[model samples]
Target: MPELPEVETVRRDLHRLLRGQWVKNVSVNKEKMVRGSTSLFKRNLRGLLVQGVKRRGKLLIFSMTDDKSLLVHMKMTGQMIYQSKQTLVGGGHGQPRVKRDELPNKYTHVVIVFGDGARLFFNDMRQFGYMRLVNAKQLEQVVKRFGVEPLSKAFTPDKLRRLVRGRKTSLKNVLLDQRGVAGLGNIYVDELCFLAGVRPMRRADKVTDREIVKLHKAAINVLKRAIAARGTTFNSYRDGLGGEGKFVRMLKVYGRSGKLCVRCKTILKRVKIGGRGTVYCPVCQK
Candidate 1:
């Protein structure tokens, strides 16, 4: 699943490539994954001019002309690839990597042809992704369900404290809840817990104020660094420009279950929190 940093990198890449470009055609091969009838979906998107691309949580919102918005969620194993006469730039899942010469292959479910002879392909091997067209009102309703944007100015330490106040759920659960923190997923949440020196299974309400400050700072720091590096790419993930994220090399806790802790020589441990594998330093993290 593409998290905040990964989604943000895609948003930036698509916004730069698709902005000011007019959609000349739309093709939908997998109708079941789209919102409406295949014909209607194609009609709604065919001639719309893209204003820009924006992201709320894990959703990609493509602002188009005529007050229309195209919302796409690349659930899991989804990739967005943009190809032009001169360039091929994109990022997402890499498994069965979309060959530039053999595009619109077996996995491409949606293809948007632009007026400039360029094309954007949405491919999902598992076919779990979806694309929907909405009016401004619907768009507003969709984005309203998300919680605070962690990269926004609104996510302060006090705000984070208020979110976890009186919550008996594990801190991991609280952070993973999109209603509490919009863009955090299992990977970043585990990393955030390790950075804050807190156990993932700790009750939210038991967190100290000082720990809240550390959590807030860790969230900001990790996100900024991840975005700067594009995102974490393991086997499937990649940046919008089709480059691997450098942050994976900088990771300290996530995916380092049996490794030595960077801060302490103690071996790290992995525990299941909310059914997700969470790794942390038992000696360094509470």
Candidate 2:
């Protein structure tokens, strides 16, 4: 899964290549990938100019000039490739093929044609990703269930403290909860807790005020750094241009289980929390 940073990187790259482009046509190779009726999805998007691309949690928002938006969730193995007149940028799992050679691939699920002979292709082997059309006013309603954006100004230490208050879930589990704070997955959650020196097994309500402040800072800092490095490419994450993110090299403890801790010489330990793999330095985290 392409957590928040990877999703944000894709959003930035897609926004640059897609803005102002008019949607000449919309094609859904896999009908299940379309959220609503196929005809309604095409009718709403075709001929509408793309104004911008934004991201909420792990969802991509394609804002249009007609006050309608296309929300795309690239779950698990979803990839979006853009082929323009001059260049091609592919991101997600699997290698990207040219527009003409796209549909032959088993993973190709959706394609959107632009007026300038450019095409955006969505390929997902898992078929769990989705594309939906929503009115501009309803956009908030669609994403309201998600928690605060970690990168937004609204996510402060005080806010995090209040959110975690009375929660009995483990700190790692709390961070992974989308309803508590969005965009954090197992990778970043472990890294955040490690950086904040908070043990993953520690209950959220047991976290101190100072630890909450550190955890808040760690979350934003880790995400900012990951975004700068393009995001971690562990299993199947890539940027909009089919590029692997460099942050995996900078990872502290996510996948470095049994490796020597950077802060302390203790070996990092791996365990399961909330049914997800977790990594942390036993000596450094406590």
lDDT of 1 by residue, 1-286 (tens): 8899999999999998889999999988888768877888899888999999999988899999999999999888788889998778767666766557889988889999999999998888898888999999999898999999999999999999999999999999999999888989988998888899999899999999999999999999999999999989886455788778888898999999999999988999988987889898988898
- Against the hidden true structure, what lDDT does model 2 obtain? 0.85
Please, what is the whole-model Cα lDDT of each candidate in the order they appear? 0.89, 0.85
As for candidate 1, its clashing pairs are none
Clashes of each: 0, 1
Clashing pairs in 2: 90-242
Candidate number of the best TM-score:
1
Give me candidate 1's TM-score against the actual structure.
0.97
Worst 10 residues of 1 by lDDT: 90-99
Query: Candidate 2's residue-wise lDDT over 130-223, tens digit each?
Result: 9999996789798898999999999999989988899898888788888879888888999999999999889889999999999999999999
